[model samples]
Target: MTAAAVVLAALGAWTDYPELVTLGLAAAATLLLAAAWLVASPKLTVVREVRPRRVFEGGSAQGTLTVTNVGKRDSPPLLVTETVGGHRTTVTVPALTAGHSCTVSYPLPVARRGRYVIPPVELGHSDPLRLLHRDRAAGGELVVHVYPRVHILASITSGGPQDAEGQTTSSAPLGGVAFHSLREYEPGDDWRHIHWGATARTGTVMTRHVVVPDEPRQLVVLDTGSAPYPSPQFFEEAVRVAASFCVAAERSGLPLQLRTTGGAQRESSGAALEFLCTAESSGADRGLAALADLLRDVVSGTQGVALTVVTGRVDTEAAQLLMSLRPRLLSVSLAQLVSPDNTLPARPRGVLTVAARGSEQFASNWNRLVLR
Candidate 1:
């Protein structure tokens, strides 16, 4: 457009056309005015804030922008642009008196789990023709953490640890060492731990299920592999499942360790929750074998820790990997985070499988299976 305008002006001058010259001059003046409109930067102050800096996916939140004109004259109406979690929005800030201020409130994107960042609030203005515009940073950035939906699950009594803080977990005898004790083989139990001699003598499957009481500590594992999930929603359910256990452990004042296949390892709920907020499905560690070393390192620091593994779907390899932790862990729980729309997974042998379809169902099933 600028080139065309200049061409018209030059052609008119070359042809000595008065009307064309007048038209060209007018167009040139319009362009100059447009450029000048934005060039005149105004003095204003901007502050952006996210109400309740953190929220759950089920909750509502808002972003507030405060604009103040510090100049000697009144400020013109300006547009404010914001981006949060790759979501962008524009808001109109009305003109303000030099000493006065204007506040604009907009809803935040909180329907999903993420660590959202509201970049520096941008104060901008466009010319009447909308051909020229100006933008300037007004305020610092802010972060809003939206965590996964945490459903009230029946707190599973960890059967191995009695915390000094008055938290008592289950003390039921579970298989740990060979020859120390033997119990009937159960689904999801490790076949390697099977007592072959006792089974032959009793004509029944009996395996070592030993339990040694210790301090209250639990491990929460989340499968970040995309292949194991039937759908994206199922993976989100897995995250929520992991989040529930992490928070529950924190609330109960129990020692906790959180591990994700994406290589996130945290010992506290604050760190774990932050990780889960932005956790994504990945293709790493499809069989959860990568976590074996992580678990091994965990047990070295603490003995008789309870284990909970959260994932979408588990195949034989994954199930076997989970079962392998039974001897070292006080208890092993395989939580299949099944969405209501996804297909249910078949029960795997030699492991405790809790098919959680929803928050309510998970609460009931978890309490019944683990709390018992």
Candidate 2:
């Protein structure tokens, strides 16, 4: 445009045509106006929020951007570029009158498991003609942690308790087959015993935490070494499998020990799901080197705690390690995620092994094979 304008002006001067000169001067004035329009930056205060920062996989999260016009003049419309990890989305914020505020909301993707950081929005301004543009940083980083989807695989049965699948307690156990005190609903508590009568009377959901004799604490170990998995997908399935066990423990309202072959261990901690959100497959068989020490610690200190190992494949050495740890616990179970064509090594005689192709298969296989 500048070149064209200069040429028009030069040609008009040489040809002595007044019309060409007027057109060039008009074009230059328009360009200058566009620049001047953006020179007065919009004075705004921006606040960004990620509602329900922690969500399950396959679920979605929402982000809201609030912009307030703090200047004496009206604020121009803005273009906000929101970033979620490597993905980016741009949204338009409507103009706001002085001392007023407007909010722009957008969806954030949580389709996969892991931690994602949503940084501050980049506030953008442009002239109505869209010629001149500028952007300034507006807010701070908001973190969204995506957790594994816990399948409602196990049905809540009216049948006798029998220590309910995952983990348990002291001489006082977990169940409603026997009556106990009632309390309000907590996230990890089982939905089976929702004291309907009390819930109706009080208008609040409640559950009965019945106590029984001789409850067992459980240890769930995830084999995170890379060698066991033929592909990355199998490792992810294994993670979901491990998470299922932890969630079961939570539902049972008992103590659970969660550990990984990479030396990451959580003792009956409620953050097992959070820990697995960022769990990854590391290099070499050497990554499984810490499994023995981690298990040995649990074996020496605790008693009557059942053990379950979730893995991708059971190799000779891995099977041997599990076999050696079997004698110290009351029961040992193995959950393996393997490809359709892969052949698994022979599991120890007393240890139970359930093989599956994915998280769905793992859940189905566990119900059919172990529950029976």
Candidate 3:
């Protein structure tokens, strides 16, 4: 347009045409006006808020963005770009007068498990003709945690010895159905537990001393070593399996401990789930060694602990290490997530092994185990 206007002005001067000169001047004025409009920048302040910052897989999350025009004059329409879970969304904001604000709300993606960081929003301002524009970043980054999938289990039995009535046998003489000693009968003593022979010989009423069994403790270990998993998908499945077990244990009022190759060991279910949300496969070779140390500590510090190890692959050496700790543990169980075509190893005498292709299959196989 500028070139054409200059040509017309020159032609008018050469041919002495007043109409051509007037048309050229009008064209120049339009160009100047467009340039001036584009040169004026819009002053805006942005504030963003994300609700339910933490959620489980397949859940939903939402966010709101407020944009205010703090300049002295009315502002033109602007484009706002938001980033979530590495995906971008663009929203158009209507024109706002000074001291006026507009808000936009959108849903965030929570299709998978991980920690997602939402970066600062980008505000784009452009002229009416869109010939020129500028972009500036606003607000701060926000982090959202997405936890893994959890499946409910029917029962959590350790498959120890049981009596005819289906009650689990106690290993200690004091805390089980077995009689530990005889004591003088108390006012509230059950008549069924009375020792008639002791009472007749000593001329005093005596009762049997029996201890009640305590609930079993479960320790869940997740293997995050990259070398064991031929693919990343198997490692992810292992994480889900570990998370499911933790949830089941907590629901059943079982004492639960979670240990991961990333060196996270937490007793609270909430803390364990949080750890799994951000856990990643480690390429380093120290995972197995760290796991060994963790198992050793568990064996030395506690008794009657039921061990459950979730891993992508379990080699013979790993199996041997777990078997060696069987004496300290009440029971040992292993869940291995393998490829569809891969064959599982034979189950050891003292260890229960469940092999499956994914989390659902592993859950099915686990529920079938008869834990006492």
Candidate 4:
């Protein structure tokens, strides 16, 4: 049709025929008007649904788009494009039958950990003459959360409990859970501390002071505020720290609790990464609430649980709340982790400030603390 119009216009221009020009103009205008009408055409009824609301990097999911033709006017074939997270996929919805419905399905390969909003579907339909096209946004958006990949770790450590004396306490004798060895008792020893059989054989008295292993009840609290926009790399570095801390504590069979002031859903061993990745950094209260929930289920046994916080900023109120839990905690702010020029938190005797470097620095600092 366009070729014919171009030929007619050319012939009119060459031979001075006015009818050919008028006919060509009318034909071109009709095609354009039809195309505009089709493009401006309202979607009869369009709906979208997403599956697997949550996914991990490298995981795959699907979505369904249902379109029903309810318009009084019939239309030709239309091409639909679905854009998500800067990626685009196209589908063709064939010419619809009146009152008929069609569903289109597409796959989304989860490649990164972040929230994604599916963009509106742009539908393009052209006129029968194929000289013009109409386009319109067809559907609402679907949101998906993609969590990052977690690297498993065991026997990780952040630092020592700020106060050793504060963690010690005398309680009812615990059976089969002695963490320390005993010295030869010189007679006035508590009978309960005596290994009767051994005492009888050695004919000696002995006493036991609760053996305190270097591993203390350590709590790693991560502050996940995106206020200043923590670099993606830095965010992941913090996650690795949280995970490593959990793994290290767990590996030593020390009572360990993984926490964050960013989101709930904390896990002891298997839940470290999920909690870290899925937890959102909306506010400190939200994050702390989530961390508290996680702590509720934690069983640290007899170890003196220490609190080590990893966060961007120190909420004084939050810190005060934590202080009530233990006299003092070894709070390490990542920004202040390294020092010389950086300002440090007020010298809370137990709190240690350390700055985070690259991956290598993170590992080295972690290793030093764990080894120490």
Most accurate candidate by lDDT: 3
Model 3: lDDT equals: 0.79
Cα distance off (Å), candidate 4, residue 189: 49
Cα lDDT tens digits for candidate 4, 277-303: 555555334543344454454333454
Once model 2 is optimally superposed onto the true structure by TM-score, how far is the C-alpha of residue 133 displaced, in angstroms?
1.4
Among all windows of 10 consecutive residues in model 2, the one with the lowest summed lDDT is: 155-164
lDDT of 2 by residue, 246-285 (tens): 8887677555789888878886635888898999988754
> Cα RMSD (Å) between model 2 and the true structure?
8.9
lDDT of 1 at 203: 99
Off by over 4 Å in 2: 1-29, 153-215, 268-270, 285-289, 342-345
C-alpha TM-score for every candidate: 0.76, 0.77, 0.71, 0.48
> Residue 173 of model 2: what lDDT?
48
Model 4 segments more than 4 A misplaced: 1-15, 36-43, 72-74, 151-218, 222-372
Supply the TM-score for candidate 4.
0.48
Worst lDDT run of 10 residues, candidate 1, spans: 163-172
Work out how many backbone clashes candidate 3 has: 5
Task: Give candidate 1 regions above 4 Å deviation.
Answer: 1-4, 128-131, 160-214, 298-302, 338-351, 357-361, 367-372
Among residues 3 or more apart in sequence or in different chains, the pairs in candidate 2 whose N, CA or C atoms overlap within 3 Å are: 173-212
* lDDT of candidates 1 onward, in order: 0.76, 0.78, 0.79, 0.59
Candidate 1: tens digits of C-alpha lDDT, residues 219-311: 888888888776888788888888888888888766688987767789788888888998888765553766677676766754457788888
Model 3: residues with Cα > 4 Å off, grouped in runs: 1-43, 70-72, 97-100, 154-216, 286-290, 370-372
